[model samples]
Target: MDSIPKKLYHIHRFDSRSGLELYLSGKEDMVFGEDFLKFPMMNLHYVFSRGFICGNLLIDFSIGAFIHHLYSASNIFQDMIIMKFNEKCSMEVRRWHGDRTGAFSWTHTKTSVEELEGKSDETQDKELNLKASIKHIVTCNLEEENLAHPLVLPLADCVISAVLLDVISKDEEDYMRNLEKASNLLKIGGHLILFGLLNTTYMTAGADRFHMMKYDESFVRSALSKLGFVIDYCAVQRRRNVSDLVDYSHVIFIAAHKEK
Candidate 1:
């Protein structure tokens, strides 16, 4: 007799709200909480802390409605353009930016960012600073032939994407294509900063699981090299939080410039 096959948790369509409330909102708890925040928080701080070419425009394609990563960048960039996959997420971003009701509090994340910068006494000043720097929140579709069409999406000086490719890519082919789309949005010689959750197959957003591309550090390097990006910094941090939230072993942060 043939045995029943194991059910795949990666089947469910990615529910963005559940993910927003659970991990990405910066609310920490004992079980499977804060790990999502833990890995990228400090690493992003360090990367945006210094180095790389400074620019006026920064394009962000981060996971969920995250803004903590922008604090460090605020010191450098004069303008920031956020790209969201859908309208709902875009509204949430706008809500946060507008200081409206029901907006997730990122105060803790901001506080953490300040501490990283060695600040003891602070206020809403830092958060307000970041809010002022946000120039636009644009919606994007990956399937569209011209990804940045209809909108005046200008070539950016730098683009930063955190765990986005792994979340959206169905396979290596999709990964490369999505990568190329992002690369197109960047100016020649501009930097592309990537935060990859290595070896992750799926991520549990609340109780639902979403497919994540399984790739390693070597693959990321090769992908960037294929695009003529001269790698400048690559830092790999081993998994810090053990949870069923995401089956990732390492978090890889890479900063590279598009040479050609």
Candidate 2:
């Protein structure tokens, strides 16, 4: 890919509660650090939405439903990009759900290789090759192991993904694994975007104790730099006060490119 304008792919959802919606809508009046810049066009891949209720039904339905709506509403052939990753089967199911939602098409793949190849190609068709040319790419992930999947590493021009709420600090091994995955997935000179919470505690439906990683801009930069990524941009923002109890304090987004 030639060095063209940076194309940003947001790997989050478009719900009123999630900060992503505000950032994309330009409602958030914050700016990146002096050294940071914005991508040309932002494309969002939503894994879940806040429309559904927050109990068991919400968890079960939103996972598949959100992606379905996102694919239906979005133009896959856009310049910028954003994506979410679950395991192979879950991702496949999401594709299927998206097909049923509206004017989208989905093909079920039985094998991991098939799923990876299928989704990656589908995403590329919508983003990278839109103008019959390859441009800058950025991918974000929420699942740690998903970053390690064969399909994820090579497809992304830049990878930006992170572990779940409690996985980062509570489980050191898991955090290291995620970092390793991010390092391996990104190509030399590719960028990686990261997001995480700081100093908060919450509980999931399964009674999982969730704790945030007390990370700031410098801490994140140092960590990624150790893995051979150069910090290009870093921004920290506070979550808005809302009725929802989900503690979204200390929002952080990073743009880091791998060194040759």
Candidate 3:
């Protein structure tokens, strides 16, 4: 008798609303306030606000990339391209960017970013800039030969991937392959920003669970070094809550420059 394969969740099973409500929004949730939220606001604040060369073209190979946090990038990069892994994610972003009614509310994220910046008046400006800077929100397949196949996307000056590989990759080999694909999308000496979940197997969303690849800081460092990326900054946030809402021991953020 043949063994039955375990059913694994993919982007097809992703619940964007539940994800927003559970993990990405609200300051009340410890998981959102301390771990996940802090990862971007802190890491990106350091990179974009500082004297880093944000360059003209930026690409984010992650779902819900600018939907929640990291709104500050719009002020730095000349143009941004968000490559969504699935149509549903793309549509949500389009709705938000287009200012369509009934779009998912991101007011909490906006407030968090404003609080971090120590200003409130520029929120509308930031939103407008973000909507204007994003030139495309095209569909992508990370496993494809060309991640944004048939689109002739530009080689980015900087690339961001947050919690994307751990969710999509089945193992270390797959992770490395995807990492190489990300690096390939950048120009030489370009920047690569990474956000990762540390030491976990599964995450829950509205009573449904999804598998995640378990990885550590050392693995991340080794892989980046092997790929000829010089680490500029790295920060890790250890788990602060033991709630069953999310399963992860830490959140890792990294900024690396592709040397070759």
**Top of the candidates by TM-score:** 3
State the lDDT of candidate 3 residue by residue for 73-182, as single tens digits: 77788798888776767888888888888677767676667777876888767777778888999988665789888888879999988888887878898889889999
lDDT by residue for model 2 over 1-260, one digit each (tens)?
Answer: 12222111113222211222222222334232111112211111221121110111001111111222123123322322333332332443333333434322222111221232355546634321322221222233445466433444333454435324222343444455656665665556655555555444431211122333444556566677677777655556565444223344555555566775
Residue 221 error for model 2, in Å? 2.0
Instruction: List per-prediction Cα lDDT, in the order shown.
Output: 0.75, 0.36, 0.77
Choose 2 or 3, whichever is better by TM-score: 3
User: Each candidate's TM vs. the true structure?
Assistant: 0.88, 0.46, 0.92
Task: Put down candidate 1 lDDT per residue, 109-136, tens digits, no spaces.
Answer: 6556656877746546777878888899
* Cα error of candidate 2 at position 15, Å: 16
Instruction: Estimate the TM-score for candidate 1.
Output: 0.88
Q: Is candidate 1 or candidate 2 better by TM-score?
A: 1
* Candidates sorted by TM-score, best first: 3, 1, 2
Stretches of candidate 3 exceeding 4 Å from the true structure: 1-11, 27-30, 64-66
The candidate 1 region of ten consecutive residues with least summed lDDT is 1-10
Q: Report clashes for each candidate as comma-separated counts.
A: 0, 8, 0
Show the lowest summed lDDT stretch of 10 residues, model 3. Answer: 1-10
